[model samples]
Target: MGQLMGFLNIERKNQKERSPLERVNDWNEYKEAMTEEGARKQAARCMDCGTPYCQVGVTLNRGTSGCPIHNLIPEWNDLVYRGLWKEAYERLAKTNNFPEFTSKACPAPCEGSCTAGFVSDPVSIKSIERAIIDRAFDEGWVVPKPPLRRTGKKVAVIGSGPAGLACADQLNKIGHQVTVFERSDRPGGLLMYGIPSMKIEKDVVDRRIRLLEEEGVTFKTGVDVGKDITAAELKKSFDAVVLCTGAVKHRELPIEGRDLQGIAPAMDYLTASNRHLLYNEPLESDLDACGKRVIVIGGGDTGEDCVATAIRQGCKSVVQFGKHGRLPDRRTEGNPWPEHPNVFSVDYAYEEAEELFGKDPREYYVETDKFTGDENGHVTGLTTGSFKKIEDGRAEQKKWDADLVLIAIGFRGAEDRLFGDFDIEKDPSGRVILADERSYQTSREGIFAAGDARRGATLIVWAIEEGRKAAASVDLYLDGKHSLLKS
Candidate 1:
């Protein structure tokens, strides 16, 4: 601890944000950088605890208890507090391959398990982390350090998301020639298109992809594996193949009139809007929510993103529906302190929606029944039923006007289109069948699976962890020795 008992005197203050009224008018990051002094003060609030649970990454009761990548939080906090910016960056780089992505997009499960939060507010760890990485880049501390010698083994990574990128990065650093294949014109599977710019600007994603290219990772875009090329050809061309295709098959809202026009999946809507913003292309008429009464039918992070996107698109009004009731203000008995406390707070989208519409757009305890359409098959309104809770009975149905509807329900599993072509065995739920409990190797010897393909839909941090471990497994298989690469 750089400053003993500093937690007693310091009050928690997170990073500032642009005013909602001003920020909603443009597509830029809502958060502003924290001052050096503010970040240092926040880092100094780290308490001297013998057991640092913040870095003890694990799942308890099916909830994340800490950082999944096992970040060295206390060491970096002390380094930042002592004004050793470069040292902090070094420590951060040892664990996380991309702090810039996680600091902006991740939910920050590390702070939920902070020991300091037991007595007072949790340390602003995410803000300090962003500050360290940003300073490192500004000082030219981050540069390409590719391996001096090549191992003469070629590896193919089949997706360019966080998991694939991390696996490729570790393998390239360890002297293997790695190539990444992406179906889209650009890399970064979810980060490039699925997420809105308000959360993380596209330049940040591009900056890392460019860095990877400089470090000896070849990226081939606009090439679908199962369609453009056969899986058997890829297996013969590369020494080994790693599958990182994410869980992208969105779950459907199979109510009546699902075939109606103006109803679309949330990912499709986001990808279209992101393409429009980045490439200046026209948005599909049904996907565009401008001047339309938009209704998002799922209450999750993706739903929130839809709400924010609709607001930026100049929607006449927006509303979100969640089947469950609102969360409690404080942690319940079932959710303890270090178990990723399940509580309620106003998220950025909610704040922006409140600022623009003069009320929160979320309607809790509401479930969609069916969609009503006009003569042209365009959605006009929807029927919803409200209930106090799941344990109780449902109330009478009510009608709400809606011009566009976005189904933001979560993903079911990975797309099964390529599984049969690859000759890969998949579980009934569509996840790849691994050889064993502790291995990343699939039923096929040369092919390995990681990230969402094996684990279903999960957090980005877990995906990175899966990728690192899979890289280690691949390295061991290739060289017939224990891998030195960190997992």
Candidate 2:
């Protein structure tokens, strides 16, 4: 609203990314930051629309329409446009615990639901958000602000992913002594390992982890809760326990030859690569794609990450298979405005694959039949059948050569065995049975579950929202009265 018809006067420009050919050679972040002026101009494009849908934060027709955490989009856009970088960051931090992570990795349902997008391009909300947070860090505005005093109550948060971290951060801010436990070597469960460095550099994840440590959140790495520490011991040690353990039980292709030597779960592949990159672990000792023909089964962010990781590892060739047909170039009639678009566009990994291999690596509408292995017990290739529709007759099966097959199909629920020691009820799908939707408390008293553990697999933003709500619920349960902590 700073400029009259700012939406009409300005054009949307995204941040520049490193050239695919060059970026594929290293594990550095791909996207570059936008100039301050460019970001301000982009913020000005947030038109003065009544009922800003960009922050509606609702789900319509099974698709998210806006920001899941309900960021104050217009307020910050105006602040950025007026060159109030600090104010913008303040407004952003009010709701989002980690703007840097979201701005870099979130799919940006906010932009998809922007009122401006009804006619013209949506405002560059993600870029402006990134600019504000990155500037805040550069100016040293983001620092540890521990609570004025301790509340004497202690909370134990299991897992160190976004949901767990957010839950721990909120509780710590409210004066509760919070301790986070991660089963992995690093504290950041998903951010540090699941996501490739090209999307979010390791330094960014480490910076936040260090800040949390400085703010009085204790992190215990390489500590498996069920095995290393018993449920009875944890209950006796902490006043309350919050399970933020994510849904990491990967779904497997139960078809024949699934046990082949070269086949591995997508998360294992990504985790191995990231560990090798950060900890200098021998890639060959785990799952290395070097000089191998890689095939990624299933599609989505995980599959894209596999493709990008393989490219970085100097794979001979890579291909991704999706059982569904290609999405339309434009939104279909059913997917209207305010809904996250279901249209097709090239993602970074696809673009990089095309640049290096001279062709897109996506093979849609293909269903894998079975794996074919050589006598040495190593995977050689796989057979896939093409389908025009879900019920249609499949075309003749075709064989594709692949030395390594990464299954990115998706996750089920949390690893049930981890919670077996505790007498907590879970749904048939393995999700913890919450006492109620209003309270994230699990079946047992003083125990709560959030994020993927309660909701199954979901976006990081939703996980953050779940964590905040769980924190508020926990605070109420602990105080036995109205809690000041915001959900």
What TM-score would every model get versus the actual structure?
0.98, 0.97
* lDDT of the candidates, in the order given: 0.89, 0.88
Candidate 2, run of 10 with poorest lDDT: 427-436
lDDT of 1 by residue, 1-487 (tens): 9578887788888889999999999999999989889999999899846888898889998888889898899999999999999999999999899999888888889999998887888888899999998898899999998999999999999999999999999889889999999999999989889989999899999999999999999999998989997899899999999999998889998999899999999999999999999999999999999999999999999999999999999999999998778899998999988989888889988999999889999898887889999999999999988756456765768899999999998888877776786788886655544434466888888798888888888888888988888888888889887655545
Q: Candidate 2, residues 1-487: lDDT per residue as tens digits?
A: 6566787778889988999999998999999999999998898888756798998888898988899888989999999999999999999998999888998999999999998888889899999999999999999999998888899999999999889999999989888999998889888778899999999898998999999999999999999999998878889999999998988889889998888899999999999999899989887632899999999999788999999999999899999999888999988899999889999999999999999999999999888999999898888999998766457655767899999999999888877775677778887655544445778888889989888888888788888888888888888888776554444
Where's the lowest-lDDT run of ten residues in candidate 1? 428-437
Q: Which stretches of candidate 1 lie over 4 Å from their true place?
A: 387-390, 431-437
